[model samples]
Target: MKIGIIGGGSIGLLFSCYLSENHQVTLYCRTINQVNMINQCGITLQKKDSSILSNIHAKLSTERVADELVLVTVKQYHLPELLPILDKIPQHIPLLFLQNGMGHLDYLQKMKHDNILLGVVEHGALKISLSTVKHTGFGTTRVAAYKGDMQKLMAIKNTLQMSNFPFEIEANYNEMLIRKLVVNAAINPLTALLRIKNGDLLSNNYYFELLKEVFQEIIQVLCLQELEDTYFASIVSICQSTSNNYSSMLKDILEHRQTEIEGIVGVLRNKAEIQKQSVPFLQFLYTSIKGMEYKRWDE
Candidate 1:
């Protein structure tokens, strides 16, 4: 199978290396420097057990991607600019999303084609440099056929599984998405607000209290969505498991890059307004992150 990875960040690059071993893989990016490096040398993938200098086809545009399966790994905030380019990709080919938040469904539903699969990847990787990627931890990726034909998607899933990728099929997708949302709302905001790594949030009571409050707000919303409270504990477990990881938001803030704050927290705040409830904690986080982002721009 020929697979096109849209975002050439750490996770996308890592998957490209792994998938390229047995399949035709292309790492697509927007930067000329990145394309030059991959073309000059190769993608340096440092795995837990071993390392490899995998040769991957790199491109700067989707003009060359004809009938390959595409994986959208770009940040949530960039989806609007990224999704419309699918017209260049063939309509019958499958496209899977490896994103970090909810709300993609509505945008995807607006597309002309429905060959979309929603994927939740748990694998963690750190992009140390432009040419280097370190596979930090292990986790399973969950995939489900959202609005598309399942033939190509199932083939992709089976191929990944046979290639020793750690992943599973989520039985209940709404529940899975909601559960992931609560976890992101709980951990991501606190880490971004405190300017701390994901693990450090657990040691700070002030941050933990803030997270608990956010979780409570999310629980109320989840209850309205008819989800049970048992999913609440999973939020705490996510923090504990990925405690040492740098959340995408925190990473963005530290590097002075744009964050998915609006996509993740802003979405919740919008929903809160619609529900006629005041989410003080989420509101505070949204304001704080936005303020910091503005201050950086001013400087």
Candidate 2:
């Protein structure tokens, strides 16, 4: 199987290294410097005890995407810029989106492709450099077909699944994405704001309370109370499992890079407006994270 992974970030690199082990993988990088580095040195996947180097083809994202299956791993904010590039791809090729929010669904609906799959990545990865990524945590990837034939998608899923990096097919795309969105909305901003790791949310009483409040507001806005216990447990379990790892949003802030606040919290804000409900806590976190981005830009 030939796989083309868009975005050379942590998730993209991580997927590239694993998929390359069993299939032909091509990593699309935003810059030529990244392409050159990966081509020269290959990509390094670092684990706690050891590291594995995988040789994968690297190319600029501007080039054509002709692979059989493509994984779009870029941040939600970067989606708009890639519209032109995605438009050029053949519709028969399947495109799988691995993002942190549900906001991308709206954009995906407007695309011409018929084979679109959405994936929720539970694994935690950190990009150590242009050609290196550290797999901070191991988790399964849940995938659901958004606009494609289920049988075809299942075939793709079967080929992509491995013991180390498991991929499961979800029954509903909306449910899967919403569950992930709520978890991200409750966790990422708070972590980014407090400048704390995932564990702190549970270890600190005050933060845990705030997390519950935020979760309540989100469920109210989305009418997700019936699954409250399920979502809450999922969030708590993620924090406990990845306690020592800094969230992607926090890492972005620390590196003075733009965070995905709009995708995570901004999506909820839009829904709250539609339902004519005020999510004060959610709004606060949104503004607070946006302010931090402003500060990053100013400095």
lDDT of each: 0.76, 0.93
Writing each residue's lDDT as its tens digit, candidate 2 over 61-113 gives: 99999899999999898999998999999999999999988778878978998
What's each prediction's TM-score?
0.92, 0.98
For model 2, what is the C-alpha lDDT against the true structure? Answer: 0.93
lDDT of 1 by residue, 41-102 (tens): 78988887887888888887544675468888887777777765776676777888877767
Candidate 2 residue 63 C-alpha distance from true site, Å: 0.6
Best by TM-score: 2
Please count the clashing residue pairs in each candidate, in the order shown.
1, 0
Clashing pairs in 1: 199-243
| Candidate 1, superposed: residue stretches over 4 Å from native | 150-152, 224-229
Error of 2 at 152 (Å): 0.6
Look at candidate 2 and tell me the lDDT of residue 273. 98
Q: Candidate 1, residue 36: CA error in Å?
A: 1.2
